[model samples]
Target: MKKLNKNQVYGFIAIAVLSLGVVGCKATSSVEKTEDKTVPEMFAGATKDTLNSGVISWKTYFKDAYLQSLIETALKNNQELNITMQEIEISKSEIKARNGEYLPFVGVGAGASVDKVARFTNIGAMEATTEIKPGKEMPEPLKDFKLGVYANWEIDIWKKLRNGKKAAVNRYLSSVEGKNFMVTNLVAEIANSYYELLALDNQLEIINQNIEIQSNALEIVKIQKDAARVTELAVKKFEAEVFKTKSLQFEVLQKIVETENRINFLVGRYPQHVDRSTGTFNDMVPNVVSAGIPSQLLSNRPDIRQAEFELAASKLDVKSAKARFYPSLGISAGIGYRAFDPGYLFKPESLLYSIAGDLMAPLINRNAIKASYNTANAKQIQAVYKYEQTILNSYIEVANQVSKISNLEKSYSLRTKQVEALTNSVSISNELFRSARADYMEVLLTQRDALESKFDLVDTKMQQLNAMVNIYRALGGGWN
Candidate 1:
């Protein structure tokens, strides 16, 4: 390192210290509060510097090809999401328009007019000429036609209009964040629905398999009854059991169709068969999440970021509203040429130019200003609460999904064992009934238990997968 002059070294130290203080102040100011409030708690934890602060691309986060296609379609064609995107564009335009109001506006213009002042009027009485031009007499009343280049601008004396423009920019940024949040939710929703369709498809397949098995059992019972091996009662019981299971198959079929349509609707298309591989739902190892810290939620959640932007915007809005109490300044200017005779219209004496400045402030009866100020204050308060609520809700969702993931894992294991036991019991009961050692009711009950256990197993697995998807969404990972 090269040695610096003593004074230069001190100056560098001073700047370094100033930068440190600025950064420290920013960190403190951004930290609204602190609590490792898990997802179940009422408020959002602080945004951590680490949560999704790593700039990762969203497309890379979700690598599923089918899911990627659905998200792409939704981004392109989903009505509500597209509308929100347009709203973001509109907000940006408002920022531009507000900025223009602070700067000078210039435009071109043209017009033609024949004006005849009434002889009884003051302007007419003061005229030097009492007679009209030889071949170009003035028309009755005033037919005035004029055209010129004009410009107007509001001078930002108190920085009021400039602040308004900045406020508009803040709102525009908030709208963009809002769209980002929508996208996060949209992508997660499509993934969840797609998984659900796969789960339903698996469920239908299971139900069909169970129905076939039950039908075979029914056939066995009919053969034994015909030979007087069991009785007519056992045959009827088996037939009823088969019919009950077959009824369940229809319910699962309906769910599969409905779930597919739901996915199609999200893809922004008509209800139709959804093409998907059920293998993903079964074999897809859900992404392992690092719940780094409770404070990390602020940065990880889109809703929370959105709420922060709205809070900033609301604060700016309040400032803009307060500015209404002060005076406003405006300036306008125009330049052109005009004359009664067309030949003299461009002459130097015919040159017309004017510039003016206006200062306006509310003196009395300022109900509109007062109302605006009051409304701004009300909205500010509302924004504060909404921000708080969004934080709380995001944390809650994360916590629930995290907890659900753990619990569902355990539930699924138990259901798996339950299915095995019930399946064995069915075999044992059927063998005993054949020897007239067990009652018909025992076989029917055993078969029902086995069916229920299998269904429960599938349901538990669905919850596990759904929890993983939801937790990732709550963590704001997908939108990144």
Candidate 2:
């Protein structure tokens, strides 16, 4: 065998080193440039207080027992949430797979094979001249049997496999955060729908009460018309108002049914009556919400945290991709027994073992690797944008809900006063009409206005409750 001289070996080593350097520089240059955007420390026009509602648990944040029960059920039975949990599991499996890539793969197996060679071939002539025993000739057909354990491993000199494993871990964590975000949304939706159901119930009650009042007014107007005190047109007008209110009653009823079914769907159950408090809807008040500093969203909001994890994973992916442009070292080994006869397979004379290694690098047709590196860099940039977007969205949601809660409170107060004044006018107008101090038209208009004001008050109250629920979710309260 010819051996390489010292100078030739040194020159080869130098060429390899220079090639690696060029590839490393090229890999670095392949990374795309992107703008650096920093997250804001506080929301615009927000107070500096750190007392956020996000720290509160959903159980404590929502005071209603029925709402708490519904949220619990949804968390356990919701299909989308279950699917997210499975994604988390899949990410965990990916971590295991990536980890295995860096570690040695070992396997044990046994096999048998038969081979027949041509008599005129070189191997056949050699076999015909050789003898396994003094008086025995080589077999015409060869039979091989082996039992062995083998191992193969890739040396992560560039930390490629390690970085890939780390990326998988980050993705697993991101999937978990995604599930938490889903929980927050699911809880908020059920709460808002529950409040809406309560509002619809109140409206239905108001309509029923108005129907009775208008029916009595209609009877009064009919008697007055017969006595020649009021015109027939007045009686017809009163009857028409009663009919309109009765129709509204059905509309509100339909809404209640739809809301209840929506709640059932969220809870992952068949359509059924949802349990809720209908009597105290008018007396219900929204919980006080606290908007903390915007920076808290980075830690508290699930979507933001999820995006942060994805960004981390993407950065690791870029590193792994860049490593692909560098040389990879791999080693393989096997130890086994082999023989032409199965009876000799376990003998020490038939034992065989081998070990080998390889160093491989991409020198040509590297467009695929370069594209992968660029794509990874692009995804990293996208993750950064998504993370920042999540933060901005969280802050805006909280800010909007804070403002909505404040405005809803003021509106509720005004609606209460309006309801009180209109309610008084309704009774006063009825007495005046009976006493001939006012016309039937005035009584009819007062009752209709009073009913509408009451309905509006219920709606405002519902908005307040919905805003409270939304702010809690926006603050990332429910998933903990």
TM-score of each: 0.82, 0.95
Write candidate 1's Cα lDDT for 1-480 as tens digits: 988999999898678655544432221111123222234322233323344411345477666787788888888888898889889899989988888877899998877766666776788875534455566544455454455789998877657677778778877877877887887788778888877877777777777877777787788788778888878988888888888777877887888788877777777899877777757344565655545555667776777877777777777776677666666668999998766666667778778999997766665576777777777777877788888788778767766776777778778878878988999998898789778788778888888888788777777777777776777777776665
The Cα error of candidate 2 at residue 407, in Å, is 1.3
Best by TM-score: 2
lDDT accuracy of residue 301 in candidate 1:
72
The residue-by-residue lDDT of candidate 2 on 177-199, one tens digit each, is 99999999999999999999989
Clash pairs, candidate 2, are none
Which lDDT values do the candidates have, in the order given? 0.72, 0.88
Model 2: which ten-residue window has the lowest total lDDT? 28-37
Give candidate 2 regions above 4 Å deviation.
1-14, 17-21, 28-47
